[model samples]
Target: MRKKIIEFKNFNFKYRVQAEPTLKDINLTIYEGEKVLIVGPSGSGKSTLAHCLNGLVPFYYRGDMSGELKINEQDIRTKNIFELSKIVGTVLQDPDSQFIGLTVGEDIAFKLENYCVEQKKMKEKVEKSARLVDIDEELQSSPYRLSGGQKQRVTLAGVTVDDVKVLLFDEPLASLDPATGKGAMELIDNIQKQDNKTVVIIEHRLEDVLHCDVDRIVVMDNGCIICDTTPDELLSSNKLGVVGVREPLYITALRYAGCDINPEMSPKSVKTLNIENCKSKVKEWFEITTISEKQKKCDTILELQDVSFSYSQEKQILKDVSFKINKGDMVSIVGRNGAGKSTVSKLICGFYKPTSGKILFDGKDIETESIKSRSEKIGFVMQNPNQMISKTKVFDEVAFGLKIRGVDENQITERVHNVLKTCGLYGHRNWPISALSFGQKKRVTIAAILVLNPEVIILDEPTAGQDFKHYTEIMEFLIDLNKKGVTVIMVTHDMHLMLEYTNNVIVLSNGEKIADDSATNILTNNEIIQKANLKETSLHELAKKCNIDNSIEFVNKFIDYDRRVR
Candidate 1:
């Protein structure tokens, strides 16, 4: 019989600041060598459960707890944080936050050093771990200079070097590009197979996590586990959407085509999914779901002419980059991490002036205008909400922009309330910022920018840490604003968002513009997808396998149909 690695019985926990329990009457069991994926909407107690397992709940968070929880058959209440670390190792969403050493080698050796391992043995372990993660050549490189994927590998090396029996990944793919995310998942799969370790992954990107072989999937909502089942069973059921979790795109597409897939038909990854059994159903659905083509707009609202910028002479971030964004356009800037996607947004927003080139807003040179003047016409929402939020109360934060512009008090009240309602934060207008969840704080920052009534809004990874429900809510609001003639430009690594929402896509590679075309065209081109380090959607591959004519066109039209129906 397999050993039970972790167990929870009638577990309940309430934060000191909240009135209700964050985790309610939880009962769960995880066995050795089992890979489990935990998914839920924001504030659904998924992270809280992870905290409980890692000894952060009562030890660091100071929460009121009741019930029994065990790790390796030992009561967690009897163990402190330091003791828990020996058995359960946690790798956080932001790998940089977990890094303690300046270089890759040092980072991997940190925990071993703490344990007073011999110098020769510590060096051997660090080198072995680095090799496992395929980063042996980067051992001497600084962690700060590594890409998102490399930094994550360094963190993984550090966690695994200590011979921990259990591993916890807290949204490992949250900040990575699609290709890098796939690599990370594959690395985890290899590690699990080699070590036979008990692994648990907490994430909102269900589709991405499904790329690996998950033994079971646990769905949470409102601090309760609504469903616990295998991937096939969960995908076959209608419970995912009901609980505000997003189902995989191919699965969603099958259902949208009016086909009831087999309950036992679960494929490990989208790339390897066999759709031969459902070809007829898919063909019928494709024939019915047709959409008309949209006409292109030509009014240029923002233009970058031969722009070049550099933090120092040693490195040039953008070189002779040029592009024009039309008014009312929903444009997406996409590329791999460190490919200069966010830099383009910053240059447009006047956060960094180009060393040589011109940025024009409404045919006027924005470089000549004051930062305050430029901000009035263009608003930039940062990637991190905590960095943007300044006011204690949500109401004041949203209303501050208008008050600074010398707007009347009555008008400020009217504008603030309307934007808050649009962003779905009206009910919590008077609540303190500290009381809000990460997703809620994100809405507050966007609401603050919306009240300013800018012509164009630039968002950097706006939906990075958001759940599917909140993501849809925020995007729908942006779509409504776009219809009213506000330009939306998103810097993102999410292919689904780009294909479903944006009309145009700008491909950037090493701070240079590679392609400017329709979202479908850019994604469907294998050469461009490879050159830009973008992942091809499974829907596109499925269309080809079904022998469907005009596969790209079919995928594009289906996305349009899906967007309209939603």
Candidate 2:
């Protein structure tokens, strides 16, 4: 039997500022050399549990604690963050915030320098760790200059340099594109195998994390551990949907096809998870499921023609990107991290002047329009909520957009109230923005834009790092808004959202437009999926294995059926 490295018994924790306990009566034990996955929705206390392990909960967070929490047989309450830092290293979800040095080499070596390590040894260790994470080549480059995936590697190298016994990854996939995220998972797995280290991952992206094998998966909700079991046992059960954590879409599809997943039937990869009656049941389900025809696009509410952009003369951000978004169409703009997906939206919002191109809103060129004027018709919610949130209080922040537009107090209050309620943020309406979690802050920013009621709303990575429940609420609200004649454009890295919610997708690669077609059409094309750094829905793979000629229609029909059943 492996040694016990982390143990939490009857543990409860409440932040100094929070009204109630964030973690309640939790009991979990992770053995040394074990890879455990902790999963939950936003505010579920998974991140809090991770903090407790890394000595951030009681130390940095200044939380009230009860019960016993021990790491390596030492009580955490007795140790400061520095003591625990040597035992467990943590890679936070946001790499930008984790950086502490001007360049990659300095950032990775910051901790060693603090410990007064010899310069020669520190250099050797930093280079070795960076090489392990495949980030050694960028040692002298500014950390901020690298792409999201590269930044992730730098952070990973930073943690490994200390050679901590246990590695804790909190939402590691939150920053990378799907293909890059897969590579990251493989890298972490390889390091663990090489060192025999204990690995604990806290993430909402369950399917992606499952790319590597895990010994156990611990599910949490409402500040409690709802289930602690192996992957086979958990996937075979319906607990994922009940706890509001997203199940692998392929698993969900299997259940929808009337073929329940059993313990023996479950596998880490969708390619190997074949059910006894899967083919027959799925084909029958497909036969009976009728996909509704797509509604005709009403008018050209927003159009970008021959758009080209560059920050410097030598580098191109977007090149000759042309696409038309109709009034009330829910569209997605997707690509890799540095593929300029967000830049396209910024140009549409008049944040950047195109090097040479045309942008028209309602049949007129928007070249002369001010950003403030463009925002009146089109609202943009940035990928990072912190970038947009200004007011300290929640209500003030949401109402700021409306008030500046000279709306009356009564109307502002009513509008803000409705938007907050729609966003599942009504309860946090009076709370300080700082007190909220990262995901909650995201909701507030969306609420701020939603309260203004723009004709077109463009959200960049809107559902990134959000829990499944909130993702559903926010996307459903967007759908409702679309039904009521609001056009929605999402710049996202989430493949599930792209396929399930958006009808049309615009693919970009190397600053050039690659494919502009229906989401189903684009997703089924392996060439486009690989080129865009996007992953194909398992539904597509299932169709091909089942000998279905048209994977596009299979994906489309299954999505329609899944939405109806849900």
Candidate 3:
């Protein structure tokens, strides 16, 4: 009989700094080889639960604890973090923060070195793990220089090299691109199946994992496990929506079409879900309408004319890349890791000088523009909020840019408050940055940029570690900003965000532009999808399969069904 790999019986915990428990009475048991996904909105105690399982709760974090917790059928109270590490391998959300070595190979070998493993055996394990995670080519490269997805893969290699029985991933897919995220999901499933290892994933992006052979769904809310069930049953249940977990987009599309359908149906078996009945429901929902008034008036705001960039004399990162973002346009730049999406943003903001060609903003050459002058025209929000934040308090963090530019103190206060309200950070204005959750920190970063009121805004992976609700709010806020003439360009790997928020899409592969066109057009094109290593949005595929040329309605139906199922 398989042993229970993890057990939480009437467990409750409160951080030393907090007045209340972060997790409460979380009763859960994960058996060997079970692939479970724990999900919730931001601050729902998902991270707290993960911490408990890996011994971070009582070991490193000073916290008030109640109830019992066991791993590998042994009480957690008896083991320190190092002993737990022998049983459970943990991969955190940010890969850079966990990296201990300069190169990928060295990073993967660090943990083994601490265990006193012989150098020969360590090298063999490192190579094997590197190949397993498909990062053999990156073994010699500096981890700091790799893209976010590559960094994440390297972190996985480091964790798995220990040959731990159970693996815990905290938002593993957050930093990965569509193709890489899918590959990571498949890899996790493969590991679980081949080794009979217990797999626990805390993630907000449910779409990919829902189809990846998950065993169970553990939904949390306000420090409690509100529901525990199989993925199909969870998706099919109405309580999930009440509890606020993100349902599958395909199911949502079906629901929006006025069809009473269950989201709990396995996505892999979508073909058998009476797909024909779903077609007309979707048609009625969308009504084949043209682009909204807000979607129109997207005139050319910035143009890259045969732009090429290189940091070294050896090779160009961006090769003659050219694209246009019209006024009131929300455009997404997407590609595999290290494909120059962020580099393009840097060049547009004058952080990096292009090797050849030109960038035109509002029909004026920006190559000669001073960094200070360019700062007034473009607001750049980096991927990591911690990097952007300088002040201790949220209000100060939001107002720092304006204060530096010599704005009046009173006006800065007013603008800061207004932007905070817009970004849903008003309630926490005076709170310290350390007190806020990751999603809240991201909002603070965006609010700081928005307060600057620049003509153009660029966000690098804005929704990377955010939950579904936060993701939607940020996208909607950006859409509103674009409607008011703030041209928004986002460097993203989020396919759903691109489909729902952006009007224009740019596809890149191996540092070269493969396609630039309307979001709908680019997403539907097989050539671009293949070249860019992108997965098709489920609703988009369903429409094509059912001969639904006008896709809006079909997608809407899915939206409706998805809501009902959730």
**Which candidate comes out best when scored by lDDT?**
2
Lowest summed lDDT across 10 adjacent residues in model 2 is found at 267-276
| Stretches > 4 Å off in candidate 2 | none
Write one digit per residue (lDDT tens) for candidate 2, span 58-175. Answer: 8889978999998999998778899899899989888999999999999999989989999999999999999999999999999999999999999988988989999999899987
Q: In each prediction, how many residue pairs overlap at the backbone (N, C-alpha, C within less than 3 A)?
A: 0, 0, 21
Kindly indicate the candidate among 2 and 3 with the higher lDDT.
Answer: 2
> Across residues 395-474, which tens digit of lDDT does each residue of candidate 3 receive?
99999899889999999999999888877778899999987877788899999998998899999999877877667677
Error of 2 at 216 (Å): 1.1
Q: Who is ahead in lDDT, 1 or 3?
A: 1
Q: TM per model?
A: 0.95, 0.98, 0.93
User: What C-alpha lDDT do the candidate models reach, one value each?
Assistant: 0.88, 0.89, 0.82
TM-score, cand. 3 vs. native: 0.93
